[model samples]
Target chain A: MSAALKLVDAPRRSVALEVRGVSHAFDLGGKHLPVLDNIDLSVAPGEFVALLGPSGCGKSTLLRLVAGLEQPDVGALLEDGAPITAPDPSRILVFQDPTLFPWRTVWKNVAVGLEARGLLPAHKQRVADALSLVRLEAFAQAYPHQLSGGMAQRAALARALVNDPHLLLLDEPLGKLDSLTRLAMQNELVSLWQKVGFTALLVTHDVEEALLLADRVIVLSDRPARIVTEFLIDKPRPRRRDDADLVHLRQTILATLGPVHD
Target chain B: MSDIAQGGAVRTVASVPIWRDGVAAAAAWFVAAIVTVATPDVVPWGSTPLWAEILTGGAVLLLVLSGTVQWLGRVGRVVVHYGPWLVALGVWFAVWEVVTAKTGWLPKPFFSPPQGLLHVYLVDTTRLGLCVLFSLRLWAYGFGSGVIAGFLVGVALGWSKRFAYWGMPILKLIGPVPATAWIPCTFFILPTTFSASVFLVALASGIPVAILTASGVGSVNRAFYDVARTLGASERFLVWRVAVPASLPHVFVGLFMGLYYSFAVLVVAEMLGAKYGLGWYLQFQTGYSAYANVYATLVIMALLTSGLVKLLFVTRDRVLSWQKGII
Candidate 1:
């Protein structure tokens, strides 16, 4: 635990992850299906960035490219000034399904990413600490089937954090939860980010969630998607949902997204 | 003052005694026995004595009585547990005895009394045991090989698009052909009778399993694979650790089906060519006109098939316990 604390003292001021003119497409029966178009973004060390868009706008695609799950057809993504060509444990992605191995209990599921990277033995304490941070200590031995949606997502978060990834990529991690659970998880995520001080890049369609959680929200255009707008939230930590300033920001984003009835 | 209580009690009185069904059944049996004895020559088969005829009638009556009791006592847990099984056994024995002994539809020399068959079973326990052991050995070898080979092939085909595209069509074309049809070719190609049996059973069983495993692999959530890829899992880890584990429920279903298929194919294979095993013993008994032994062998095969199927279910429960509600 103290060793992880050492990361906090390491200049806390360098660029953690960078996306430079990254673009991607899929092969659709000899036709190019453009997904993300020349997306360029950067997140400073310990900054929380959100890529917000409508469905099929390739917010998730951008996250995948940055995480190095899919190589961009053009340009490059870099982490700590190194060119990203393949996935690395330094950038871990938290998925919507929690995707915890059903056969493994909560503790084992959290430990898998570390184990996959061959870091479990040295980081076992860190894993436990992360699980405790998620308030899942009592459910450490419970199977994924036994967990509610929120609990499973918490375990997924714990798994990503156990590796002490420099960039924590979230692909709509709370999108599947009910409204009440989603709000609670949003608060938990922001608080955890504050405590851990890790750089985060979240992909979400919910404008409010993006406004509440991100330091900067990057909105993408529909299909052949590219960055369309960027908003910086200057509100202080633990901002309330009912905060007038936050509501104003949300309305501004909705306006940028276009007619709500349509 | 007590007159009202007495009137109410009379209104609430129970309908009949519990043994009323048994009593009625006994009377019906007596009538049937009288009719059967009076017309023995006209009976479908005349081998059974008048006394045996009466006993068979009584057994049928008892079966009906027990069935009625089970229906009436459906709410009672104890009756629910044991009643249906008792009635089923009684009915089965009665029908079997009547068909073979009281009816001449079957060849006379090839039929035996149920008591005579039971006596032969108890007396020749050693031979029966040996036959069971031989049949089980073949079953185990064939089923085990089929399941392992099917899962391996399934995973390979599932993990790679290239493999699936080329291999799946070929497997589909060949899978539907019955295993029994391969007996003649195997007889000449294989060195031993048992090897042929094993090979035929495995071939028959593995096709369905491979198809099932591939389908299972194809159905794994695309998101999970993306997550694995994003997490920096190697290609090997993705296939074995992620893809295979994800597709396990499908694999189990394939294995279960394979087990049953192998057992059926094993019997057919053994009967056709093998020198030893339950199927061979059945053939030998039929040729010698020992109809009771043939019936006994058939019963043994049924029991073995049921036991093996149960074992498959138990193994499935253990392996896929993770997938209880996921489907």
Candidate 2:
């Protein structure tokens, strides 16, 4: 608790992200299949933004480009004023599957970032702090296979947080979770964002998830994803699902997403 | 009153040692000693008195154990579990003695009585010991070098596309051919018979490990690489820390195959132009019609091979402990 309190006082060094005229496509067999088309977006430092889209709208592709894992066919991604060319410890992406290294204990998995950067010797305490942040200290010695679904995902979050990443790219990080765990984790994510104050970009198919967590929610069209609309969620913290304004926003976003096609 | 009576009966039963199997084993051994001492052999075999004395000793030991085994705890359980086998072994020995030595039904210079085997052990201890040492040294050198070279080749083939392209076809071509087939060429090509024998063993052991390890490394999930990369892992870290550890289960499979293959090739390799090995001893004894020595050596080979296989199993269980529930 003291460490978490100390983190609030530590100056936040979050960077503004800019995606300008970004377009990407995949070569499936002999044909070119476009995924993202001419996307222009800017995120303020320390802001919480969520991208809401259909199942295959290429929202995840945008996150990968920002992470510098893959380059866009056109245009550039900038971190502050500098171009993002390759993956750096300052930016971390968490996937829906948790993807914890199966061989390592939960503590070792969370310590991976620090170990990779050769900072583990100096910043060992950060691993404990990160585990405590996600309330996984008791399970630090457990393997990924031994953990429950929610605990595994929390361990994944702790793995990302150990690096003190300036930008967290969440590609449907909570998509695979059950509804009850999803609700609890959404609140935990809000608390984590408010406490640590890093710029977060989440991609989710659920409109309510976007409305509940994000400061700004961007919706994208299907296939070759283009920005359809953006909603500013100016609700206060601890927003209720039944809040009249959030309900109205959910209904509007759902209508725009078109009839539920399940 | 009835409950108290039942509890007293249970207590009395618990206090009494269970001695059924032990008594049976003791009787069998006693019979074996009686047969060895009372019946005259169709032909003379030395160590007959010593063998009878050994059987009587085993009978005495079993009779003593039946009265005391309950106090031995864990060891007592193991003794009880193997009690039936002990009885069967003693009966088997009595029958074997009657057929081979007492009746001469199995004939001489072909099948030896247990006493004949014991006589060979007493007379040829020095030569047998030397053969065991020589066989172990050749096995160690061939198996060690084969596994190391195979592991390196497997890693290279799995990791690099260019290496796989050049190496895969060659490996596939030679992998199915028996290593003994190369003896005809290796004997002429290599300067020494020792070198040729070592080459044959190495080839037999190395191929399976290479094939299995390469497949193991190749089949590792690609998502693991992606996860490691996003965590700021270097290429070296990805290979050593991630790829290598992930592929270990497959490598172990390869190791087990290699171990068995090496044993097979070692015996065959030793049979061809080998100076001092168990296989050579077998050939030399067969030439002299020393079937008793051959039987003794075969028993030694069985114990050695099975003991090595058990050692491999223990090592696998220790190294792959993390894979317990997952597998």
Candidate 3:
């Protein structure tokens, strides 16, 4: 028990995530701005869930709560039946921005999780492996600025994947890419998730994207976000973008995200 | 914008052989020779005929130096680039020598010929070398400690709100005041004049670094911290690894400010107390109306400061090489 905290490992450990009645608010100077209200979500192990919502609907806030970067004002987030009170290497978040440390090379950025945990010396090969996984072994020595937008995001993905995270919280990780790059990355992400089998909670506003990639899509209400509606995607792997089933589901999800009607 | 365009034109011209160095350097040598050999000293205010011979020798040396440009190393390349400036310098020197030593247009005791300054170097090399050594020691001790401590404090203030709450107001208050303003109190607090001088220099250089470092650390994109935190960074790792590296550019800016301030304070401190430094030499020479010595010391100071600044620039370029399109 005493030596448990200091033990070393970088092996994959996929786990379930549960968010129970989580509510959160921020104090901007003196004003109280509510962001999330009574959010209840449960993700099964190895599930890929896409969260779709209206703009400014606290999608990022909910992701932050799950990543353990912030504590909810009320309720709790659990991973594998254990409450998450603080950030751990087991659960990593990839932000909308690549957020690659500008001073470090792509390889070093990928090594950050292991370096932070003092496991870098033993697991150096993992950094190279992660870069190879993103097909960026050619760019290991390159800085973030030296890379294009698509490459930079790929490096960010490598940085997250290097940790062998149990849960990957993606906050619109592909939001800033051009259309062609976004399409390519969407496919790459689906394939990587399939291989790694980590439970994924992706936050995105693209309705078709959610339908194409996610096993389930959950929509949220506008600011002070609450779970509004959800859809179960039962299609087989490698679903086509122009497929009739996806087209119909995208329309439904878009309507749910569109303006409210009395 | 026009200046950059002009630089582009000049760069293209630089590819030519004669335009790069030969024509301009030859012109400089010709002008310098004409002024030195043809003219006679007027109303000799204790002027040396030997200086004219030396100027003639310099003209011949320039011709030889220009011819060997292709064979000379890095310094040779620099001479080629600044060939026009060298010609202008020759013209300026001719005007100076004629006005000061030959015609005596500028009055005595206030101005000097270039050779007059050179004479100080030739005669007083030992004393000047000692002063140089002392000044270097003082600067090394003061600026080195100041930068290291200030950087750590700046990181702390930027990283933790509680640290900032206690430190920021005090830093802001102390930052604006000149380092020399504390001279009276510094003398009483420190045991020796040397330590007192070091404190002043340290204070001068440390403040800018601290302020700039704080701002740099504090202004880092919060997303970086979020990512690092989720990767299981401890507080120590966040500070030393994340905050320090992110804030380095700002810290360097501070280091530059401190370097200048410490030098300014260093000179003033030497003027005040028991010291063998360039500042003391300047003060001592000025007291005796040795304008030549003062000018020589000023030249040394300029060269030293510029060299140090270049070194700092090289280090910054290496460390922040990841930053894009800065130059």
Candidate 4:
């Protein structure tokens, strides 16, 4: 698959987002409980990285820290050598649910981040281009209620893309989708990433999804989660579902997570 | 020529009615008239004439026939949907007229014969219209300000837990007190009677809006806020754009409830001090023993309340159309 895409020879840029020695916890009724402990990660510009772990492994916490939605108690997150203090338009997050505003049409939802940034005049064409890229041009004027689950997620994706974010954080964005739509969106996401060349950090419990999408997969341990292992996919864009090497990697990650004995 | 074509034509043709609905209506009217005429009242009937009885019976018949025609699809869809209700209303009017005219349980002229009340409705249109306008103006002013303030303060309290913790208790302490309870204080604090009424109405309505909006904001999915944060929405944007919209459905519920309270409070406030509102007219008519006018005012109040609610429903449908099939 890598040979077919021939992306390996393409010039790779420096890291667009970096996290070092980050830790986070919550004060639950006066008792502090740690969630993520001593995390370190880096994403080169145009790279696709996946954080795969069990339900309580705090992969989402790591993504939030990098997105500036939450602050790490111990360490720093940097974008282009500058520390990130708050959320910026250069980092966009997509969630498991579409989370499109119920009052807005698809076009308005896609344009919301730009509108929020007061960049409508400067980014109007970019918004339309992003929607077309997601193949949702026909649904631009349709409200969220009029869209199917798959279409709504695509709109959410378009909304994230329109800003041309330097870092894209996906927190189990496909977890709620049906198996077929999940597979289809996984392909769409990979192609979009390749074309747009934005760095991506996806968090998912599905080992296969991680292997199929990410250039690098980071596995995390249980509560007070820390990085347990990292595996490089070495596969290419438009990678096959049944690729022998990808299947092997999925099985390996599954075994590392837990036993399948019955 | 073909069996399928013949069957379709037959189905279409079979849909028409064989008899005119007016025949059935006339039969029902004839029976009612005969029964009323035959059953002579031992006591003197109050203010009801033979002509009025006949007219009321005919009106009932007309309503029933209209409903039947609608149900049979001789008319359009809206008529068919509202047909039974129209028929029920006609019957209700007929029964009320009969009971008031023939029965001794009600005082004379207090429950004015339906004809007299109807006459008041026709003749007093100007007075009724003015009262409706007065009430609606108060409603718009109070309800609008209440909803806006509720949403803003609610979002503020909802976003910060510390604010919610301190503010919620204060709100709870004050919110349970009815809006009408402040009427006495309003009279003293406010100089003008109309202004006082509006103040009472707004205060009464605003409390519920504030409480409901806060709770609505509190109930927003935390994950959604996280999404907004990641998208780089500023605190102001998060509250106005994300939190407010997300909590709108619940906020609407509060607005509706507030509208109801506003109407009730407005009437009370007006009756206590104002000189020109519907409540004032109601009190004046009752004092003068103008039974017909009193009933007319009561009818007007019912119409205004229901009409305001219907307007809200239409606005809600338009604004929240995106939530179709969701809630």
Tell how far residue B241 is off in model 3, in angstroms. 0.9
Q: What is the interface RMSD of each candidate, in Å?
A: 1.6, 1.1, 1.2, 1.5
Candidate 2 is graded, for docking, as: medium
How does model 3 fare in lDDT?
0.85
Cα displacement (angstroms), candidate 2, residue A55, comes to 1.1
DockQ preference between candidates 1 and 3, better one: 3
Candidate 3 TM-score over all chains jointly: 0.91
Badly placed stretches (over 4 Å) of model 1 are A1-15, A121-125, A260-262, B1-80, B91-107
lDDT of 2 by residue, A1-262 (tens): 3443244455778899999999999999989999999999999999999999999889999998998889999999999989999888789999989998888899999999889878788777888888999999999999899999999999999999888888999999999999999999999999999998999999999899999999999989997999989999998998899999999999899888887422
Please provide, for model 4 over B9-127, each residue's C-alpha lDDT reduced to its tens digit, 9 standing for 90 to 100.
Answer: 43434344423334444444444444445544334443235535665567565656554564545454554455455445545545654565545456565666565566676677888
Q: Pick the candidate with the highest lDDT.
A: 2
**Per-model TM-score versus the true fold:** 0.83, 0.94, 0.91, 0.84
- Tell me the tens digit of each residue's lDDT in model 1 across B1-327: 354576754453344334444544454455444443543432243333544565556656564554455455645446445544545554554555555555645445677545446655776689988988998898778877877788888887888889888998888888888888888999889998888898888887788789888988888888777766666667787788788888888887787778777877888888888777898888887898877788778778888888878887898898777777776
Model 4: docking quality category: medium
Local distance difference test scores for all models: 0.77, 0.90, 0.85, 0.77
Q: In candidate 3, what fraction of native interface contacts survive? A: 0.94
lDDT of 3 by residue, A21-135 (tens): 9999999999999999999999999899999887778999998989888899999899999999999878889988999999999999999999999989877878877888899
Count of clashing residue pairs in every prediction: 3, 0, 1, 0
Candidate 1 vs candidate 4: which has greater lDDT?
1
Report the lDDT tens digits of candidate 2 across residue range B23-116.
8999999999999989998889899999999999999999988888888999988998999999999999999999999999998989898999
Predicted structure 2, TM vs. truth: 0.94
